[model samples]
Target: MKYTARRTWPEKSKSWEYLGESESLEEFALAFATDKALEVDTEFVVIEKAGAESEIEFFKVTRTSPYGLVTAAPRVESEGSSTDNATTKDEQSSNDGGDDNYGGVEAIAGAWRGVISNILMFVKAGGAAFLFFLAAIFLAKWLFNAW
Candidate 1:
């Protein structure tokens, strides 16, 4: 299944039609917001080609805990096509620099997540350390005075 991607606004129904299924307006809006927040523009069109299965599958993986959505186009091999050609194309495309923008954005997002995680970890650790130090100091002072 070869699909030509085009940019269009969401209809008044407040839904995005993906693979003939209607997603709720709120979900679509959240998806868009998450994409924008992650520095992804709405200009890219992902063409879902026919692959291993008979039908084209479009998947949007939205992380519930952390706000992020990863949209992937299913890879489909044409009937009677050689596996060698498919493998070669995939390898070539992976090495191609043309799609670097998407990868770059993803990398930036990943970096942001890593930074946030590290900060949170440090904050927790520091808080614990500080509390322990304070407790030890107070206990030593009390023991000294009592003695």
Candidate 2:
């Protein structure tokens, strides 16, 4: 997939900056992990095979994170083919920028919700038990007074 836009990194965070649009959540993750922020140039000397002209191809290494080599330009998107599907796909993928950090957020939110729900339930149960105790004490006092 090709990334064609720019995103800012969190201020002083461990996350890498995402640039451009990605095809999918997986694609975004791959790009972010492998993107190199600088250009690389290599020089080599070689003899032509039989009398063939020597050909040189340029490659740009964007980033190299845990995933692998994330490349650009060489896989450039085709031209003159913009449509709703393409635009919508871009929107969907870009909207999923949250996918990378889903685990942490989801775990924290799940834990928080569970804790809050349990606390509420405990409080309700405790309140009911206290009310019952008070009622029993009042009943005992009333019976003793009657006696």
Candidate 3:
């Protein structure tokens, strides 16, 4: 079976960065594990094909907490036209500039979400502190009364 290694960063776009093709799965796995070119948060998939006209199999490669790479089981996809399904260098380049507006909007939204999350975290901490202060005051008052 022929294995093809491809990577894509979800935060960037859906375009796949084709690494290379190999006949050995071990070679692809080794490269996926040790390749410095691959980004840390990006995803890698190995496409397996039995023959030229067979169904394509996709295996996702993920990094474990121990910094080791692991490949998931193959997920079979239906065969389609080569030109329609394939992500060539030319196609990737052409699609890059077209999505600038979409990416900008996504970035703005992400930033706003992050800000809101930080605000909520601070509010939560402040609320907890206020409750703790009230509890301490009540405890002090009870101790004074008993004395």
Candidate 4:
């Protein structure tokens, strides 16, 4: 799956500007659009392209802070199938009564990434501090022996 990020400034121009593309929506959202742009006058959309079909999802900026803009649930708008024989009974039956849980799984994976990164940072900091303390103790012992 490919995701593309686009933004439009209605006041400036009606045309949408392509920001970039990524393999995941979370990466695209985290890479594009600053807090100021989301707050001021920009409208953002993420285009999800899968095989022959594509989906355009509009994002609503819910919260804007120094970090970035928090988006509400995206409004999904499908562009329809590209091929005539796209729909089949088998496919329809497979999808019937089943909720798409990709978004949920992606969110969980993203949260886990944040937790793991924080843990790695803490470990690195602690290791560095311990090394510094060891070096200080060694230096103190050397100085006492010299005296």
Candidate 5:
């Protein structure tokens, strides 16, 4: 997952700055944990093809965010098609911009969502198979009790 984060002032979009993109959100979290800023918002995105026959490919992410914003864009195929180019965030930032050192992803905040999202995706992808697995476990439990 990719994270595009900008630090925000406490008063809601009162003043903001784009810190740039990280291949992982941990980079952003490090900043989040340490930064005195009371608020920050993040976006998540996924890229996929419409179908095997369809020439069109699309990137989508739910707009739903308990924080601020969420987004998705096609994986970087070419600079032309890549919506999340590394330099784009720098270009957009109002602050004098460059990569900041927050000592890797270990120092990040809001990681619980990342973990939850991973589990959610697993369950979503395994919808049918997961149900079957649960049913098998229930059957085994019943048989053991009967015996």
Candidate 6:
């Protein structure tokens, strides 16, 4: 994903200066707010090459989740053709539903990602706790049975 941070100058005529690229959205937002920028505009354009799948990819859901919430994956529009004029929000989500799924594969992928991320964090913390427990047991044995 490419992100450009620009600061606008309001004089007799409005002008914009490109402030280089930002690594993250948080960084871009912070600079826009703190720098007293006149206008902060984000340009979003999705371009697909000659041969690409229009549908979004899905990910498997994690079975053991603390929060029982299914995440949705982001979708890419292969059907919608681009135009010079601005695109409406209504046109974007207006996908002709062929099935009963509330959201397509993208939504499923998102849910799975969330579940996996949580599971990973739990495993990391649990691993550290287990190590500490083993150390305590070893210390206790050494002190009591020092024959």
Q: Among these predicted structures, which one has the highest TM-score?
A: 4
Q: Model 4 reaches what TM-score against the true structure? A: 0.33
In the predicted model 6, the residue pairs found to clash are: 59-109, 71-111, 72-107, 73-106, 73-107
Candidate 5 wrongly placed segments (more than 4 Å): 1-3, 6-10, 37-147
lDDT of each: 0.48, 0.45, 0.57, 0.58, 0.41, 0.41
| Runs with alpha carbons beyond 4 Å of true place in candidate 2 | 1-102
The better candidate by TM-score, 1 or 5, is: 1
**What tens digits encode model 2's per-residue C-alpha lDDT throughout 53-102?**
43222233333333332333323245544375468645764686543455
RMSD of each: 17.0, 16.8, 17.9, 20.0, 21.3, 23.1
Q: Give the per-residue lDDT of model 6 (tens digit) for 1-147.
A: 233333211111123332334554444434433443332222211112224542222221223222111223433335444342115423434543323354578678889999999999999999999999988888888977633
Model 5 lDDT tens row, 55-90? 221222222233222333333357664566445644
Clashing pairs in 4: none
Clash number for each model: 4, 8, 0, 0, 3, 5
Using lDDT as the measure, what is the rank order of every candidate, best first? 4, 3, 1, 2, 5, 6
Error of 4 at 98 (Å): 45
User: Which stretches of candidate 1 lie above 4 Å from their native place?
Assistant: 1-99
Kindly report which residue stretches of model 4 are placed more than 4 angstroms away from their true locations once superposed. 8-13, 40-42, 49-51, 66-147
Give candidate 4's error at residue 103 in angstroms. Answer: 39
lDDT, candidate 5, equals 0.41
Worst window of 10 by summed lDDT in candidate 2? 41-50
Backbone clashes counted, model 6: 5
lDDT of 4 by residue, 3-115 (tens): 66666433222234545667677566655655225554345776776655776665545445543444545433355632432354236535753223534665688889999
lDDT value, residue 101 of candidate 4: 50
Candidate 3 per-residue C-alpha lDDT over 65-131 given as tens digits, one digit per residue, 9 for 90 to 100:
4345554543333566445544653366457653435556666888899999999999999999999
